[model samples]
Target chain A: MSRVSTLLARETALAWGKGGGPMVAVGFYAGVATLLPLAVGSEPERLAAIAPGAAWVALALAALLSLDRLFERDYEDGSLDLLTLSPVPLEIICAIKCLAQWLATGLPLALAAPVAAIALGASPQLSGLVVACALLGGLAFSFMGGIGAALSLGARRGGLLTAVIVLPLFVPPVIFGGGALASLEAGLPWSAGFALLGAYAAAAVALGPLAMAAACRNALS
Target chain B: MIPEVSIQSLALSRGGRQLFSRLILKLSPGEAIALIGRNGAGKTSLLRAIAGLINPDEGEIAFGGVEPAEAREAIHLLGHLDGLKSSRTARDELAFWTGFGGGAPAAVEAAAARLELIPLLDLEVRRLSAGQRRRLALARLLAAPRPLWLLDEPLSPLDAEWRGRFGEIMGEHLATGGMILAAVHDPLPLATRTVEVGR
Candidate 1:
């Protein structure tokens, strides 16, 4: 296998193995999804009305749960140093790590969102749209959150700092995703919002790694 | 052949305090330089600067034969942190590095055997003791052959036998035209020269 594939494989394995970040994020997402019904009474109309919003919020928070670990673990363990020394550019490594985070945490959360949305009384017809939006939005979150994660490395309270930094970046995705889902529910043309969200995700994937690579270099220095 | 490393007036400062300045050193193939210093003396910092993990505040580090962009590929840095993932088995960890480093799988296996890590290869890295972890990390020095080895406090956690074994490995690496720069309090048998940092 090639170097990039080998790195992706290693990261995927780490994220899928026992006690991995994906499990924690998924569990947190499930917990948040389950609690929305309790906090706001189970009126079908009310639940259905808020289903998409709640799911999006939960997804954002869950993704945040794992962002802190992105570069922190490798940084703490000296792997980042070796990684920097390797032939591959640090930007490529950062991109691979973000991609792995998307696959491990984002993909599963996206797949599980429909179930949560349905449980919250979302119209069954919108389930497909919910999944699609979640997948795209999750990609944005993973890549953008990577910037925060990398920036906060070596900070005294790095995890909390990551959340503080990442939550703001989550706004664009949340608005775009929630708007797309809401438009679809209202029988309105939702392509515009969905397209905007897709554009944000694409931009994130293209640019997040550059910022992350710079952060990693600064932290190492 | 491995290139010679030259550092001229290399200096580093942290937290607004100057650790050292006007530092100069020259190392050729097959020579080992042991960096000795007190705590807070920047021994680790010096090693890191040479590895290109950190940029020096002043002056230059030139590789006689390699391009600056390619210098990192020729340097192996073993800091205090072992870099092993605790959750992964030793075999998988080694395999991932072997693949990533573009080294031969056969060489990784040989390195593992040399470090007496064969028994622990199937075990999770978290299960291994500190000495074992250090040895496993050292295995990377062998897994991928690099001209310059930057090792920091490599002997603190090892038992006498492993230490002796490590000395032998160092001897072999040096014989093959590899250079080592290590931060150490205790003397190493293979270190031909000692540089005192922050003195």
Candidate 2:
């Protein structure tokens, strides 16, 4: 197999193999979705009004679930040191790691988002758009969360630090995706928010690795 | 192909404390050097600098005509950390480095066998003894052919038998004209000249 394929395969196994893979994140997503209704009281009108936005926000937070360990694990175990020696550049390595994070963790949360939103009384018709937004938003989450993970390497309270750094970055995607959903609910033009979300995700994919690679190198040095 | 290593007037400091300065060393194929120093000394840092992980405060580390960064592919660095994931099986860890380092996958079995790790291949890394883990880590040297080996206390965890085995391995590596720069407070099983750092 090619080096990238090997890395991808290894990462896939690692993503699912370590911790509980998507189960933990999806479980967290489910837990938050299940609790929101109880806490807000099961008034269908109120729940329905807030369901999509709540679900969108929950998905963004769930993406943070595994971000702390993205590169930290390898860095701790010395895998990152060896990885730097590979013919592949560290930037590509960071990208592959995030890709695996998306496949194993974010994708499941994306699937769960629509279900959670609908469970909270979001219109079933909106489920399709919910899934679409979650998919794009989740991609942004994986890549952007990676930057936080890399920067917080070798840090005290790394997990908390990652969340603090990444939460602000998550704001744009959450707003864009949530705005798209809210606009659709209100029968307004939702394409603008959706387009912004896509552009944001594309930029995150293109640029997140560079920042991650630099942070990792700094941590290593 | 063997690469010549040249270090000219290298200086480094840690935490604003000077570790060493104006140090010089050179190595050709089939040569080995043991870097000896106290705990606070920069032996490991020197190795890392040579590996291109650190920018020297002053001076240059060259791997012949290759860029120091690019020369890492031809190098194997076994630091104090083995890089093995405890949750993964020994075989899986070996497979990862093998594939990542562009080694022939077919060599995995041979590497395992050479390290006497055949029995523990299927076991998770956490289950292995420290010496066993060390041997498994060392197996990468066989799986991939890198001309320069930078080992940080490579034999510390091993019993006499395994140390002798590793000595033979190092001897074999040198016989093939590879170079070794190891950091250790203990004597290496094979003959090597010494470089004192931090003094």
Candidate 3:
């Protein structure tokens, strides 16, 4: 487990440093969030209302943007085939890749939510909840998106294909994430939403890799 | 002793496309086999199936004397990409792989030198020529201590010199009771058994 974690960390660091995709996605998230205020103009109530939705959307988009390259590059280059042949099961490899992807893209998006929230005139308390929801919710997005990314390898227009395949699946996270934030704002218990989000993440963590391994097998075949 | 790896009546299909059907093969320690086929002939698929990358639809593969996941610790597969991330410097790639491979750094460095990658260690993999990348990939294989090597198109872009060097290394590996299954289009300069696919 430690070995897998270390490998995941190392791979994530490498991907974050070398690939412009993650950075570009984060940049776009910040850029879009920053522009929202200008477009809306001093409407604090309006900003607060739309802030959670925008943040959720941005987080999802950021995650989706990085999904296509998750395994496609390795698959095309034959590295994924080698990974399957590793002494490690493809499940472990997929888990490691997901960990890396979440850390590289999802974690950063979570951390960046505060900035996005502030840009949309969210109060400090609401902003904090937004970040929390994003931190937990974004992991589920990464894991689920990984499945789409892995399955779409070798498909024509893989980037577009990834988005098309993954977007419908992403609705769960988006809904629960926004609901969690709204519940927090309304002084309602947000734990249920958080719990639901956590459950999704857990399920994705447990089953996503196996699905990905099957997808890889299909792609190779 | 039982062979290091064996497959019986292996059949594989993906999305209803039958990539391979009823394939049978085996490899004992100290044996080397070459897989030959035309493009789309399933040479890579065969290597992948043997390495457990793809599950066979109608057969079983046993490694050492057990299942693939059970015998994974002793198996290594090298595909066309060499699995090296082009963005990473060769040294960084080696360091990262060594961290997981559990092999000695000295041995890896020595293999790098022998492969003439010493000077290019700091260069990113993307900067290396195709032949260089192939050698670097082979160097990685040398660094690993696994007993079974499943290679796909192992000699795609090598010149005559590197090809000879690869042959020598493979010969040495076989001499040491290591098993090798390589997919190649041309003849390799070693005592080898050939398996033709898509017949």
Candidate 4:
């Protein structure tokens, strides 16, 4: 295998094996979805009215569940140090890590997002769009979240710092994705929001690794 | 190619404290330098700087003709952390590193055999003792042939028997024209010229 594949496979395995994999993130999504109906009085119309929005927000938070550990574990275990010596550049490595985090964490959350949205009483037809939005938004979350993970390396309460740094970056995607879902339910135009979401995800995927690699190097130094 | 690592006027500081300055050294092929100094003497920092993990406050580190930023590929630093993932088996760790470091998979088994780690390879790293982890980390050096080794207390956790074993491997590495620069308080198992830090 090439070095990139080897590192990618190793990182995916680490993310999948360590910290309960997507089970925790999926469960967090479920909990948030469960509470929405209770908090909003359990009426089917009331739940359905809020379901898409509630589910979208829940998916965003659930994605955050695994972001902190995306790079912190490697940083803690000295894997980050050794990785600096790899034939692959650090930017590529960071990109691979975020990609792995998505496979291990974001993909599962994406799959669950529509399920939770439907279970919370969203229009069943909206499932496809919700899943699509979740998928793209999850990619954005993973890549942007990587920037926070790398930036928070070696800090006290690093996870909290990561959350603080990543949460604001997440707002744009959440708005774009959730707007698509909301507009779809309201019988309004939704393609613009979906396209915007895709654009954000693409941009994040392209550029987040640069910042992540820089942060990682700074932390290592 | 001699593959010498030369450091001239190397200096570094952390926070507000200057660790060391005006440090100069050279490691020709087949030589070893033991970095000896008191605690807080910047031994590890010097090793890191030489590895290109940190910038020297005031100096130049040339890895023969290799590009300065790319010099880390020619160097391996075995620091205090073993760098093995706790959840992964020793075999997996070695295999991943062997391939990631651009070596063949066969080298993992070969290095495990050399370090007498064949028995421990199947075990998750968390289950292994510190000494076993150290041995696993050492396997990387054998499996992936970097020329300059920056070892920090490489022998602190090993028994005398394993220490001697490590010495034999160091001899073999040097015989192949590799260089070693270790930060250590315990005497290295191999012959080495001492380089003091923070004096």
Ranking of all candidate structures by their TM-score, best first: 2, 4, 1, 3
After TM-score superposition, the amount by which residue A180's alpha carbon in candidate 1 deviates from its true location, in angstroms, is 0.9
What DockQ does predicted model 2 obtain?
Answer: 0.77
lDDT tens digits by residue: candidate 1, A129-202 = 89999999999999999999999999999999999999999999999999999999999999998999999999
Could you give candidate 3's per-residue lDDT for residues A1-221 as a string of tens digits? 24465478676876687468467778989877877778877688888888888878878887887788888888877777666655566778887888888887788788888788767766678877777788778788878888999889999999999999899989998898888887887889998988888888888888888998888777876
Instruction: Please list the residue runs of candidate 1 whose C-alpha ends up more than 4 Å from where it truly belongs after superposition.
Output: A18-20
DockQ of each: 0.86, 0.77, 0.53, 0.82
Question: What overall lDDT goes with each candidate model?
Answer: 0.90, 0.91, 0.79, 0.90
Pairs clashing in candidate 4?
Answer: none
Q: DockQ: which is higher, 1 or 2?
A: 1
Q: Model 4 off-target regions past 4 Å?
A: none
Worst 10 residues of 3 chain B by lDDT: B64-73
Clashes of 3: 1
C-alpha lDDT of residue A62 in model 4: 91
lDDT: which is higher, 3 or 4?
4
Q: A25-99 in candidate 4: lDDT tens per residue?
A: 898899999888888898888888888888888988998888888888888888888998776899999999999
Which model, 1 or 4, shows the larger DockQ?
1
> Candidate 2: what lDDT?
0.91
Runs in model 3 with CA error above 4 Å?
A38-42, B6-26, B55-64
In order, the TM-score of chain B in each prediction is 0.97, 0.97, 0.93, 0.97
Pairs of residues at least 3 apart in sequence or in different chains that clash in candidate 1: none
